[model samples]
Target: MSVLVVGASAAGLSTVESLRRKGYREPITVLGAEWHLPYDRPPLSKQFLCGDWDEDRTRLRPDTMLSALEAEFVLGDSAVGLDVERRTVHTASGRELQADAVVIATGLRARVLPDQGGLDGVHVLRTLDDAAALRKDLLEASRVVVVGDGVLGAEIAATARKMGLSVTMAGPQAAPLQSQFGPVVAGLLEELHASEGVHLKLGTAVTGLTDEDGRVTGVRLETGEVLPADVVVVALGAVPATDWLADSGLRLDNGVVCDARCRAAEGIYAAGDVARWQHEDSLLRLENRTNATEQAACVAANILGDAQPYRPVPYFWTDQFATKIQVHGRPSEAAEVTVAEGNLDERRFVVHYRRDRRVVAVLGWNMPKQTRLHRHHLVHA
Candidate 1:
C-alpha cells in the first residue's frame, strides 16, 4: 500500500509519522511547495521575528527524522490535481503519483492585500519566506502598522512593540479578538496593548496603502486619516489551500467536509485547517497545531482499521508580549464563563467556560496547573 500526503506542514508530517508508527510501512510520500522541512509556524511571529530563534531551531523534525521514517520528501513541488477515482495526485512538476490512500493536509495561506500594490515593506506572516522578509524590516523599522486584530495580528503587534517599534493596530472590530474572547476580555487585551505603548485604531477600515518608490510609507484609513508606517503586516487570517481539489468531487465548504472518522471520501482523508469534520451534528474545523496532530493521529489509526472516531477536544496556545495563553476545548457562545483563578488585572488568570455547571473549556494565562485541571474536566465533562 502506498500513502500520499499533499502537504508537509504540521498536519501532513504528523499524519505520515503516525501512520509509520502504526507499523503500516507503506510507501509514504510527502509533498510540499516549500523547500524547507516541516517547521512550527507559531514562532514565525514571535521568537523568530524577535531574532531569538533560527530556522534550525524552528524545524519540527530534522533531516534524520524524515529519513528514519523512509518517507519520500518531494520539496518545492505542488499537488495541482487529484484523480480521486484512481487514487493519483498530479503535481505541478508534471509527476503523477499513485496511492492507496491520500491525505489532503494543504493547510492555509495568509490573506494578502492584493490591491495595495504589493508594497515592498508590506508583508503577510505565513510561510518561512514571509517571516524572513518581515523580520528583516522589523529590525530596522521604527513604526509598524498591523492590519487585522486576530491572534496572529495581535502577536505581531506585541512583538513589534517589544522590538521598540511604535505599533499601530487597525481592525474593523471594537477590540482585538473580540469575536473569539468577547468584548469584555478583548477590552482587557486592548488595555494590555495600550499599556505596552501600542496604538489601537479599532472599528476602522483601510482605504488603501501609501507607498513611495514601491516601498510602503503609510496606510490610508477610510476615515481620511493617514497613519505613518515604515512597515505593514496584514494578518487578516487565512484561507485553506484547497483550490487544487476543486474538480476532485470532494465536498468543500469552508474546508473539505469529512466524516467523524476524518474520511473525506473513499480512499481519501483530510486533517488540519483544510478538513472540516462533523462534530455533534455540526461541522467544525480547527486551525491549530494541536488539533492537527490529534486529528492526524486519529485518521492514521482509522486508516489502519482501528475504527475509532476523531473527537478530541480542541486545544491551542499562543505567546505574546511575554504572556503565555493556553486554551483547551471549544468555548461555545452560550457557555457560562467565569474567572477560575488569578486576576485579569495581574495578567495571570484562568477563565473557565461552563455549560450546565460543567466545564467545557478553559483559557489560562501563565496558569498551567489551573488550565490542566479545567482541561481534565473538559475532557470528561
Candidate 2:
C-alpha cells in the first residue's frame, strides 16, 4: 500500500523509516513545507541559535542515508487541504496526491505576541529559518529580553547569557517550569539562571513590546515595568499547525483528535505534536522529540496491521548552562516532590514527584545514568 506523509520533520521522517523497516515496501511520498531537509529542533534555541552549531549540524540524517530510504521527498510545498473521503492531499502548488494511507505530522507553529509584528528585533525560534534570523539579530544585539519562562525560554536565556548579552527572563509563573516541576525544582532552575547572569523577571505577565522606528526597544510587563532590550525572543509555546485542515471533516480539538490507535479516519493517521490521541482514560498530546519518533513508530506498526495502542511514559529533557535536566513521566504542579537520591543542594540529584501518595514522575539534575535508572520507579509505580 502506498503511503502519503504530510510533514518532513522528525515525526514524518520517522514514520517513513519505520514503515520501511517493518517490511512495507510500497511507494512512499513525504511532503514538507520547508525547503531544508528534516532537521532536529531541540537545539534551535540553544546550540543553533547561539552559533555553536551550524545549519548542517541540525539535519536529522545525511543525504546518503536518506537516499537509501527510496522515498520521494517533496520539499517547499505545503499541504493546503485534504480530501478525507478519497485520501487525497492538495498541496499549495496545486498538486493532488492520492494514497492508500495518509499521515499528518505537521507539528506546531510558535505563538507570537500582538505587537511583535513589523518589528525588527523580535524573534521566534520554531524552524531553521526562524533560528537563523534570530541568531543574526542576536549577534549585533547587546540586551535581550526573552518573553517566557518554560524550558524553551530558560534555554534561550542561558544561551544569550553565554553569548555575552544582557538577558532577562519575563513570565507569569513563579519560576521557570513551575507548572511542570512545581516550586522546588523550578525554584532551583530559577537560581541556576540567576547565577548564570540571567535576570529573573518572573511572577508578572508581559503586556506588550515597545518599539522605536520599527525596531524593538523594550518588553513591557504587566506591572508597568519596562525591561530595555535590543532584541526580544518570544518563547510562549505553540499551537498545532492544523489551520490548513479546517475543512477536512476530521476531529480537531487542540489537535487532530485520534483513537487509541492514532487513527483519525479510515485510512488517516496522525503522530507528533499535531496529534491528540486516546491514552487510557484521557486524550493526550505530547510535544517533545522523543514523543515524535515513538508515536510515529506506533502509527507505522498499526498501519502494517499490528493493532497496538500508543501508550508511552512521557519523557523530555533540556540543557541549560552546564546542567542537563531529564524528566520521566508527567509531573503536575500540585504534586509533592521529594529527593529520591543524592542531595538537592549539591546540584546533582534525582527527585520523585508524588501525587495521591504514589510516585508519578522522576527528575534528574545533571545526572543522566542514575536518573535513567530511577525512571524505573515511575514504570513500577
- The C-alpha TM-scores of every prediction are 0.96, 0.99
List, residue by residue over 1-381, the lDDT tens digit for candidate 2: 899999999999999999999999989999999999999999898889888899999999999989989999999999999999999999999999999999999999999998898999999989999999989999999999999998899999999999999999999999999999999999999999999989999999999999999999999998999999999999999999999899999999999999999999999999999999999999999999999999999999999998989989889999999999999999889999999888999999999999999889999999899999998887888
Local distance difference test values of all predictions, in order:
0.88, 0.95
Least accurate 10 contiguous residues by lDDT in model 1: 110-119
How far off is residue 240 in model 1, in Å? 0.7
C-alpha positional error of residue 256 in candidate 2 after TM-score superposition, expressed in Å: 0.6
lDDT of 1 at 159: 92
